[model samples]
Target: MTFNHIDFYDIPHVSSALETKTNSRINNCSSSVSKFILLGFSCTRDIQILLISIFSGTYISTLIGNLCIICAVRCDLRLQTPMYILLANFSFLEMCYINATVPNILANLFSEKKTISFSGCFLQFYFFFSMGTTETFFLSVMAFDRYLAICRPLHYATIMTVQRCFRMGACCWVCGFLCFLLPVYLISQLPFCCHNTIDHFLCDPGPLIKLSCSPAPTTEMICALYNSVLIFSTFLFVTSSYTLVIRAVLRVPSAEGRKKAFSTCGSHLAVVSLFYGSIMVVYVSPTAGNPAGMQKIVTLFYSVLTPLVNPLIYSLRNKEMKEVLRKLFRTVR
Candidate 1:
């Protein structure tokens, strides 16, 4: 999608000829332009080159990995169960999740001009967080699925039918986007006068909020509370579901059955930990007095690393997935 080309150098606040920026709301927050400079990974030329190379490879590998899972699940008849179906949905989500941040990151890394249009910034902000939220909901649903399959075996098939799984997936996508509307909308409406340069790669709420011309304590609190509720509720739900799952698995007489159950949950748990671990540090934890650099590191970890890890965690270790991927390779050759 093409956006209006605005030279970042032309940004009034960025120029040396600019008037001294003040805390005063009227003088600082009234930017008529529709762009923001994304200060993405400011480092030496050599470091930038190395980062570009690393993330380029990572991005390609992540895309290929997730796409393979989506294709394998869709093409293979035996893999059409609720678990694989949800896996495919998660794969698609990862694609979007990575795509939202990485491509712009690459573009910014390669060029000296590191700017994103205002529309693009918020679009990234909205979609990236929305995708994260969707993934959270999906994880919760997957945990519930596992809990049902392991804990209530007889009713599993009945509860998580093909139609039902699709419905749940759709609901996750819809709810994720809808839930954040108020917060994002309110944040976007805030007058950003301090400076247009976002310290992080994308339009993150914490940094974006700080650039506000005036202190908006109420808005900040509302956003924080909204995020806290979502993060804690879903996290607790997933944990609770797994607790029940562990209980059910322990009841199984055979060690083999227990091992099999754990194997399935292990991959998901790892992915969840990586995603939530980095995210909680950045978002759920105290953002009140944190340094921008710390926030940058935390955001980079989840936005770049987690998506890269997801395909490996989900697709590679599974024997059936390996077989499907091999067949796909052979067919292409």
Candidate 2:
């Protein structure tokens, strides 16, 4: 699809005398722009240092937080169950997702040139998409696990067997990787004429779409529909699963039993709420007059902060995760 050409350089013509002088002084300016400038958080020197420090801390914390989850899950025999196994997968995916964006962002913040090559930008987007897709599917699978555990307690063991859980996890990764391939491929086909300044910190789809010199209505529509469907269907599945879980909890004879069930599911619910809430706010909300600053804040929440939080939410609140951590600590000691 073709789009209206958007000029990046609006050079004003000078008088003949000035033009003659300028022409004499300059060589040909005909090189195709091969790199894009990423104007990340700060333009000020002090603010750049501050931003670097903050993101460095966040990146380190993200790695440690996610690694702790993986180590905890692996060390504790009790957490060898399907739920924690799923949590391990999530932690790993989160690490990859955060790594895709944060380190490069941090590097750019400190460097003299805050730019990425065209290929490098697309590669970043690829990993980001792959990890993001995997996380979405993993969350959906986790919801299903909770559904079975709460709604059909007696059959939970029978239905959510280790083999079944592994299959589900594999499917999540495969499907996510496959689903995002088309969009990435489509993006690679479009020729970027000279305008390469990406407004946001990373190569996100929305801003990239805006940069496209080619018309992208169909691509945008397809992406919008695909994203909406994935978000909606997974959300609906989670909602339905939780509804049944709540119903089953209500039917329990003792208050303690209901409380126990609620406590178990609480962390997952919190994660779902945080993730879907931020996503809806960013993508679903109207963007006509939205400021660039606000968009960056929202983008940071999902792309940067959410990954850091997921491992913490699960490890801190879930007893199985806590048990795993305790065992891991003992083993190291």
Candidate 3:
């Protein structure tokens, strides 16, 4: 779509230019801009090249790592339980989560314009938030799986049948995609002013809402409520599940049994902490009053870094997974 072009360098907060120039641009362009300039990282040519190289490597590694986890779970008959199935599904979701944004970010790095079409931006907005919401559901499901296996060992196998596992996984994917439809639609319908530059990397709701010519307290509240309900409800489910698991573990008389249970749960807790710790800071508040630089850093933590590290957290910490991966590598060779 055709959009009015304003040199990003002319933007007041972006550069050292005065706010008058920004006001002038906004005044001059009365119509809604159909595209937006994503001010990802303004830097020298050398630094841009360096960033491209760094993020390229990170993306490739993340894809390979998550793919390996999925493959390990699939190929190994020994790893074909409910927990492993959920783990594989989670890995696939992580791959999707990172893919929703990283490829576009990489392309923007290469292009001088760094512009994303309105449709493209909203698509990213939908998939990114959807997958993130999906992750919370998956994490909670995984925790519940652990809770059953640890706290209610007798019914674990009966309750978490293969059929039921697939059903639960399907529900997570469906619900995740559905949850954000209203909020995204509400935000998209808002009339945007002449300022078409988004301060953050991807199209986030907070920045998009900030760009609206008119105030939308209802939209803002809805977005906040969606985030709060999704994050907190799933977080509570996970924490409660783990709490019961811990109590059950403590009750075990054998030290080795308790150690084994703790070891199994440790990797999931690590992944949860990394994912939730970063996102809560950004999404919990409606305004998301954090500085642009801080927002980008925190987004990177959950979006890029968490996916990159999850494979290692799962494979390295779990003995069975490591063994299965090693054997799979040998079979490939």
Off by over 4 Å in 3: 1-32
Can you give the lDDT of residue 77 in candidate 3? 94
Please list the C-alpha lDDT of all candidates, in the order they appear.
0.86, 0.80, 0.92
What does candidate 2 score on TM?
A: 0.87
* lDDT for each residue of candidate 2 in 68-141, tens digit (9 for 90 to 100): 98887777677789998898888888888888989898888878778998789888888887887787788889
Query: What is the lDDT for 128 in model 2?
Result: 85
Per-residue CA lDDT of model 3 for 1-333, tens digit only, reads: 899988987776767555667777665664657899999988898998999998999999999999999999989899999999999999999999989888988988899999998888899999999999999999999999999999988998899998999999999999999999999999989887788899878999999999888789999998998899889999999999999999999999999999999999998999899999999989985467999999999999999999999999999999999999999899999
- lDDT (10s digit) by residue, model 1, range 28-86: 35765378888988899999989989989999998998999999998898889999999
TM-score of 3: 0.90
Q: Where is model 2 more than 4 Å wrong at Cα?
A: 1-31, 287-289
- Pairs of residues at least 3 apart in sequence or in different chains that clash in candidate 2: 3-215
Which candidate tops lDDT? 3
